[model samples]
Target chain A: MTRAALLLLADGRFPAGGHAHSGGAEAAVRAGLITDAASLEEFCRGRLHTSGLVAASLAAAAALGVDPGDLDAAADARTPSPALRAAARRLGRQLLRAARATWPCAGLDLLARRFPKGAHQPVVLGAVAQAAGLEPLDAAYCAAYESVGGPATATVRLLGLDPFDATGVLARLAPATDRVADRAVRAAREALDTGVDALPAASAPLLEISAEVHAARTGRLFAT
Target chain B: MHLHHPHDGHGHGAPAPSGAAARRPDGTRRALRLGLGGPVGSGKTATVAALCRELRSELSLAVVTNDIYTREDAEFLLREAVLPPERITAVETGACPHTAIRDDISANLEAVEDLEDAVGPLDLVLLESGGDNLTATFSRGLVDAQIFVIDVAGGDDIPRKGGPGVTTADLLVVNKTDLAPYVGSDLDRMAADAKAQRGHLPVVFQSLREEAGVDRVAAWVRERLAAWRA
Candidate 1:
């Protein structure tokens, strides 16, 4: 697997529509749940082990040639909020465009044709990793890191928190990110034998509920 | 680390077959995308409303408005009855309006593509950037052409300052010309400064409150469409 390809996918500037989203950090900040760097780390940790792990596993499974349709359904069942579900599909469509242009693979095109609107972002990310010639573990790392990285960057913007402290938060969480990715890849491999049910079902109800509330409100900065 | 890869012909080393103006997934040419960017209250949305009013009957057109906090711009277009609700879409910029249009255009691109898919075979797609600083400009990957709108009430010296949007836009529109005299702006000086800053690029001095309002800008858009088709 090409390590550089993994970096390219993981990069915040990949143009996959993550910038407009705060990964629920905007709502968290608004709720006073993530007020400072320390709180931000706490929030990221909770997210990394929950939604982050599930997203990473889905992406890893997609990289491992699992059926994206089934994985997308799995993602839907795991996500309780309709607002977050719509956001995922929207981001997924955007990523599909960028991935198709970046990877130029027939598999990506077929997925695009299949889910013209979008499948789910993690599902698409895993497929994108596959097209980019990366392994399942590489996809996991990309997904796991993004789950925290997106919020950290958004928190920097939302709270006007020190950018350096935000970077430090990410650095400190690097080891945890690795662990989540490892667990995610293991779950993905197990899914191949049993079923998608073998994958992790970790959940962060607050994030989901906050996303719904954020979507319902007006004058919010981030989309979700 | 190999910073480059075999697909380097495209973005991130993969040949990109499509972008702002590229063909749709079905191999049909996409709509002509024009961006309108300017400072706050400089009449960007007003200009979009006028253009839709002037051109909607003649050409298949849609609009995507990047609003920072709310759907005000999109809602205004819808309330104005300029276009049907479906044709007018709002993309939240997450308080960074410039980034959405210039830096990472993913959300805006998705809005545009979705518009085309839903009410498509469109001839033109107008993107209005949210009110931002003078330096904001649309990325080439986002728009085929761009118009920078500034009002005479804002300042005549704006042209002389010459930020990227004012200097490099395909068309520099000096809006609210009727208010120019009221605001004590020098029309001649603003025109001369625009010429100096833009060299040979076209500039339009207009007032939407006047007779045949938006005619000049509408004509310019028609010329652009003609060129796009040719």
Candidate 2:
């Protein structure tokens, strides 16, 4: 229940293997969907409402003690791209390794045993939050923020965009991120009674489709 | 990957415990993980290739390459057919090769573990970091030991300047000794600088063009494996 664990999990330097991924920003940049700070904003906004909302809701549900298996299936159902699904599970496996080491809870260990290959990333994220004694709102915030934050950081590297400007984009989206987190928490609350059907299932086709293209791409910097 | 398999065997055994655990989660002694790092054009990949060619016949080995953008390093090893394709893998660094090797090492860690799980009881795993700077060194958490490679043409001054890679790596390799004659790089001075900085740490001057170019490095690896097994 310590507040500091949230910061540890959210830190970009957490060593959870997030640095190698671009959150679909590379595909967007190569597709010319993001050339500067402005287009980057549009991309993030779209992601925050779509896939971002879905991931946050899933995480929030897991943190509220929803069954990880159900949340994982829900996550897969919401994601269209196989490449994105694989990446999510890969990230989930890595995060579980780190979370088990950091939080050392029975639930985290149980999740690892169940999904040896991996569960979905947001499902793992929520379970990790539960293991750390974090609330659903905190898990929702982490998922919502990372949904946009990963892309913002990657764009800084991809476009050589001004670092401050890229950060400014995150700052501008703070209000929107909060709204998404709040909505995600509400959805998670509904999910508690109605099963995973109550969780958000929003999808961003561009992100999913681009992730496939990105996975097939050679000579690309980021993994996805 | 046996997706339909029951709960326990879904992937490889648990990740090899991080740091220097002698045994994997599956309860077998793990390979000796080694890291190779240096500046671009310093022959890091060539050295890895050379080592693979020299050792493949006698040992069970694998390689994990960290590349900045492309899978060029992994592809190069594949094109060479050094080890079976399954024995080698690549971890993309997102343009920060050093971070994958040194700062945040989870990706590289997983690559090695996966390689071991797939084609294992491996005696050695050489992790070749993407070309980086003199300051770069593999995190101890990532690899058990590290070799820092610098060529004569990259400046004999590198060892004297003495960053962590030069001073602290388990082995300091001054590669391209044959090029020293033509590059006007003083090999003796480089050796002296390396000795001064490294003290008792081993340094091997290698010219991959030579007949037994990789022998000494291979011997160093053998010795490490012996010690690791001991």
Candidate 3:
């Protein structure tokens, strides 16, 4: 079941519309913030801490049976970049389509019907996980892994880095995923304990600015 | 607007629907998703425009263009009036165009979906990759089939470079055939090299500048669409 869930989430064909985005790696790369594998590692680490934190939290909430609409709104509020926000909505819509096709949870259908305007990826991922029978921690880990791991893998090809070296980067990231997942689980537990109405809210601003600037650029490699 | 629900842990008690359930019924009307990828200035955008002109009348169509910095490809198609303004969507890849089409693919998928949702049904959706060097290819997850465009002007020897895009694209289009004589490109040699590299796959020598060069490509697309339906 875990393998099936992973296959559904990691297939790259799940219709989440992730193909057009490179997270914030493209912007950071253009800003000269990330070049070599070491720099890429640093950037990924930061992402895991900031944006990844938010995504994991949301995923955890969804896995714990939080309403998809609430998670979507929370994710939207947390994301700052208009471009990234737009990209997130794009991804969310695709995820919705895929989720509806693969696992038509009533909650997911409700979320899609209620707010078709602008849902984010983490929110949709959370909803899909809840519908897919995954635990909150599992969903949190999936979100964090996808949010960071996909870009790290893409970096290998984009920068022409050795595949072994790229795998090494991912290996180093495994522990970090555990840490993020632990935090997310704790947060989800806390939210549940306090009643889902008391879920914590957080946002990242610098990343949003970077996304906006990245979207405005003329020569780049990733979409966001 | 808070719509909070308690952490019931029972949401999964009921079986969730599968991803295929979300697709439109009759699925036959679903457009074929085709990806166009190649190195910079290989005429991917030109090829897309040409395909639209050649097939739009016979088939309902839409285009999704990936550009690293701007919406140039979509704009070019719009300016050329290849398809309706609403049918063209541009994804600013912000980084390597290949990453979006080959690595992540979410944004492109969303654009395609939006086009489908808005247009009801389309016969084909063209995903034009941002310009990149050889070795770039579409993720099979993102495209049903893909065409790799390489211009003779870039050098006829590019086919022998043996990159994944050149060797793996379902159809390899050696574009800008008109520039062959001027650039000293040997069309026959390039064709032979590509044929050798791709085995049974097809290759087309095209010059979008010509009146009907895109006809062969359009025919190929029709064949694929028919096969997809069959």
Candidate 4:
């Protein structure tokens, strides 16, 4: 596997339909939870530790050859908001389309047959990592980065925040993201023997609640 | 690393394109995808509404609109009763109108695929980009052919300005021709500039106020459909 494929998958412009949804940043912005660079940084920090860690763990587990079906179920259980669940599945399906076209493999084909509609995005991300021949840590890193990176980018668009400030937010979170990735890999490794329950299931209640609220609002920019 | 992907031949329900504009997974012929892009208030939505009214009887059609607010144009079509609610969908572009149609088209692709899945055997699917600058154009992967709409009122000099949309679109439509005199836009100069920019490519001058304003565009679409079937 070309290790550089990780960069391709993790790139914000990878075209997996992430541009439309703001990773809950739109809701946060609308609710006045993220008013400036400092608030955005704090929001990113919270997400990196919670949802980021959980998503990274699931992706790492999937990359480590865990059953995607079980991981998908675990993801469903972890995501409390119906809106979030729908967004996750929609993103998963979109990613699968790009993945199957980008990296055609028997495994991805089976995934398409299994969840013709979709699975959770992290489950698909792990599957994509496996198809790309990336290591579990790489999958963890990809998911961990996406968790904060998406929100940071979206906050920039939503608030018209300085692009450099947003990039700085991602830069500040990188070290923490690395730690999250490492912890996720550890959890995924533990899950290999102990089962997926051993994986991180950290929750961010506000993100979930705001997501449900965002989905209900008709006049909005982001999907969730 | 080798990125040579072999056709495993299991593309059932695959959303991306292959044998493009050719056939669906069920072995039925797919609809021709046409794109309409232009600047703000340049009559992109009006043209779409007119196209729907003119062609809906003879052709089965659907629309996918990309916009910052996301639903206004789609809602406009719905309010006008251009097509059933199910046939029209909106894609959020996060205010980057061009990205949805050009840079990363996955969302738009899925929108069209979903439309086809829900109400299918469509003769055409028109993907309308949110109003943007002249640089915005549809990715070939997203649409079979594209029409770039400019209006006499926006600027008579837009064709001479000649960006990608003006030069490369399969069809360049200079809309609001009736407003030319009112807006001080020279019709002859605009036509000449369009001809110089597009050469052999087609351009249509339209005014929705006319008795059969959309007929020319409708005829062009029908010709494209016949050619696609051929």
Per-candidate clashes, comma-separated: 4, 0, 29, 0
Rank ordering of all candidates by DockQ, starting from the highest = 4, 2, 1, 3
For every model in order, what is the iRMS? 5.2, 2.8, 6.7, 2.5
In terms of lDDT, the poorest run of 10 residues in model 2 chain A is A100-109
| Candidate 3 local Cα displacement, residue A186, angstroms | 3.4
The TM-score of candidate 4 is 0.95
Give the alpha carbon lDDT tens digit for every residue of B1-230 in model 4.
11112432235554333224356666576788999998999999999999999889888999999977658899999999999999999988876889989988878888887888899978899999999999999988788889899999998999999999999998898898989999999999999999999999999999998887888988888888787777
Task: Extract clashing residue pairs from model 4.
Answer: none
Query: Candidate 2 on B5-95: residue-level lDDT in tens?
Result: 1232213444532444566677677788999999998999999999999999999999999989999999999999988899989998988
Local lDDT at B161 for model 1: 99
Model 3 agreement with the true structure over A114-193: per-residue lDDT tens digits: 65654777777877787787778778888888778767766765777677876777789889989988898788777666
Global lDDT scores for all candidate models = 0.89, 0.88, 0.75, 0.88
Model 3 misplaced regions, further than 4 Å? A1-50, A95-118, A131-133, A144-180, A193-197, B1-28, B92-106, B132-145, B158-171, B191-202, B222-230
Clashing pairs in 1: B7-B13, B7-B14, B8-B13, B10-B14
Q: Between candidates 1 and 2, which one is better according to lDDT?
A: 1
Q: What TM-score does the predicted chain A of each candidate obtain versus native chain A?
A: 0.99, 0.98, 0.89, 0.99
